[model samples]
Target: MEIMNNDAVRNVVNDVSDQLRRALFQAREVNAANYIHVVLDPNHPVAPFDSLHPDHLEQRVPSVKFHRSMRADFQHQPELCPLVVTLYSPGDRGYRDEELLLETVDNAVSRCASVNGSYVCGWIATTLNGEEFARHIAVSSILSHPLSGRKVLPWFEPHRLALIVDRYPSFAWSRLTNISSWWFVDMLQQLRVVSPPEVGRNNIIDARSTLLPLSGRQVSAVWDDQRRIREAKLVAMAMRKAGLSLPEFPEVTLDKVVRQAYENGLYGQQDVVFFAMNCLTLSEDWFLHPVVQAALEALAGTDELTLTDILAGHSDAVLHEIASYESAGSAPK
Candidate 1:
């Protein structure tokens, strides 16, 4: 996975923080008591808490709690434990503390980037009180597997959390916790939000004893989601290598191109990437052209030619004509 550079990370974090601040103001106006908490993975080299000033650390209002203390196995490994710090409260008089906490989170995320991605997962805003919210998140972190018994689920990690929300049924996830909204920066360096399904809001589980089981099918779905995420990252990297500026919300385009590649039986990494590059370079619907479709069909019937070989064989005039057609069709009449 490509790690975002410092500037890119800072811009994304600022955008996310702005949105979170707006959420806080909106909650205050409605007289709803909400708390914003930043969750830090201690496993990261520069944890969010480490970025905080000594005075900020000593503050009692934005209290810090270890999620691992709620579980036995994680208790001894404090260094590996995840920390949740309350950043904002409805009762706060000013935004100074919240701003400081956001800055610390920004610095933490910028410094924690590895080849895999940033370890600073993100923040959460909820109506539940601080202690209740912490307990609920702790309970949700443990998953029961039939074969392995009980294990910790790093569902707080942005990518893993995204996969869970994308694949698991709303009722299954919503019943496990009482989070109003979750905000996280995705692998694409884009801010994303996950909220409880409206229908499942009132059905939250209240006790730690009611742990959700990790089914085989759900596990498989998560794996599939991970594969798709990897493919999107690959496509993004390819585009960048080619000096192509990414479109806004490029993940949406990347996902479509990757899915189209799979649908056309281009399963090999080279074939899939080649197909995606062409679609991204020309048009997402480029393969739908009659000439392109015929070329794909002919290529599919033969093992002699790869997608790259077949597509690259097209004359410059023919490729240009296809691109022109797409451009014309997309134009306002």
Candidate 2:
């Protein structure tokens, strides 16, 4: 019941979001079957979907799994259609529907590599549309597919989209709902910076936590002082409105953030896990930065405890590296 209720509310939200997006573009709704399609020229900067033309049927070969639904067939039958979509659903009670989405999704995913949150994958129980429509995000990258002898760099991913969500919620939703190009671009930027699997997993879970409270460090929420000052003022206003004090800090450096998390038990648990595990995801061959590797070496291999331990503490100005990496993993190739 709780899940269902949430779904019902989300449906309303999605619908409202959709309506708002449409208005932003003054977009006309087209032939929406199992998915939401908007009419646009493929060359247009915002086109998100590409369809098969009824004329060139012979050259396209969608796999069997693509047959799970009419929509999948429509997308993969591959003659050439100019229609593109932002959201799609497979609509089968059976897994066949989901399978079709996954299969057909690959067809479209190439466009989503840099997306923000992976197109909000999987059914979050009770959202009627998501339940049947298997949504897949497209991404763009610079990677070469070794097997195909083709450079298969992705253009979008979900983590990339988070910033868009953070910056312009209305624009993000509208474009995601109205124009695939704009939204996909947001996703792509995130994909470019996405941490590796181990890193991503660690980023979300609190591996070292014991009595520590669950914390959500939203790097996404971090902002420049200009924004922060406004935010601080707004927070102060809200607190005054509620007869409470605003969330505060004298500064917003990395050390300040970590210390705040430790003191209030707010941000570090999951982030610590993320930092520890992220070392594995990056390319094995190191680059110029050796801060992380140096730290690990200092902590594990060498010296007496207190001497290096205190030196390595966040406050110590001894070493500097990319904010994401704490210790250098290895020597640069």
Candidate 3:
């Protein structure tokens, strides 16, 4: 891709809109070319157009909303629902801004790695000389995950998930800190391949409907459910296998009970990792941890067995036992 002259690119952007011009100008100063421009329509298509060949514009292909959320959490100027994402790719360039462009693209794709409903419309810009050349590239494939263009809205919106953090402080902190885009995306993909764990079984009544309805949290939970339940079941089964016998546990359900228990300090973050690794049939390091074995035995002794059992008790002893076990293990030994 040829680098468009600064003046020429500026003129093209300015012609599009003062907003676009200003955004690009500010971003250009930092050497970034890709951008997300939120407009009235997320589905609007930018037809392919070459300034050098303005008469030969390609057809417009409809774009889809790749991610959807209301920007209500912003302290200032919160946008309402139906925010659209417009990935702006200014043709490839070798200027100092190339790194910024590449970094922006990487960040955008990685953030949308878990998106399920989005379509991509191609955009191509080829600069020739001191003039302008741009085109709206079109692709037939649905751009569901890892959009190459910069995502301009929704995913970047601030959220109100303090309740979740409050409930699952230990789990949230550790998971958030250790999250890898590749691993998280891979987890989402794996969830899609397998059947979602049956809900409303194992005496674990689905309480999602009764819980405080938060769209943002609900959406997030839906996305990571498979990871949550898979982690929960593995830990539960490990407790049983370690000869921590108790009454029969409820059937595994991909719901808030299991999700909340794990998130709400019923288990350690590494326990989830070990559970996940075990699911892959990877290794046996989890078994060697004395703390883990002790925790399992302690858990087996509890009368309330199901995930629902744990959640029903606001600050239950089982949670304390698990937390205490993890805390003891975390200390220098």
- Against the true structure, whose TM-score is highest? 1
Give the C-alpha miss distance for residue 146 in model 1, angstroms. 7.9
Predicted structure 3: lDDT: 0.29
For each candidate, give its TM-score against the true structure.
0.64, 0.24, 0.24
lDDT of candidate 1?
0.61
Each candidate structure's count of clashing pairs: 0, 54, 8
Candidate 1 residue-wise lDDT at 50: 56
Cα lDDT tens digits, model 2, 131-161, are: 1222211111122223333231112223223
- Ranked by TM-score, the better of candidates 1 and 2 is 1
* lDDT score for residue 9 of model 2: 41
Q: In order, what is each prediction's RMSD in angstroms?
A: 6.1, 20.1, 20.5
Residue range 1-333, candidate 3, lDDT tens digits:
112366754443344333323434544344343333322212321133421111221121322222232333332432222332333434534233332233222222222112222112111111111111111111101112232332122221111112223343333322221111101111111101111123333212132223222245543443454345444444434444454321222222213344544543455545443443332232223332454445455565564453333333534564344333433344453
**Using lDDT as the measure, which candidate wins?**
1
- Worst 10-residue lDDT window for candidate 2 reads 185-194
CA lDDT scores, all candidates in order? 0.61, 0.28, 0.29
Q: Candidate 3 regions off by >4 Å?
A: 1-70, 76-99, 106-266, 281-297, 300-333
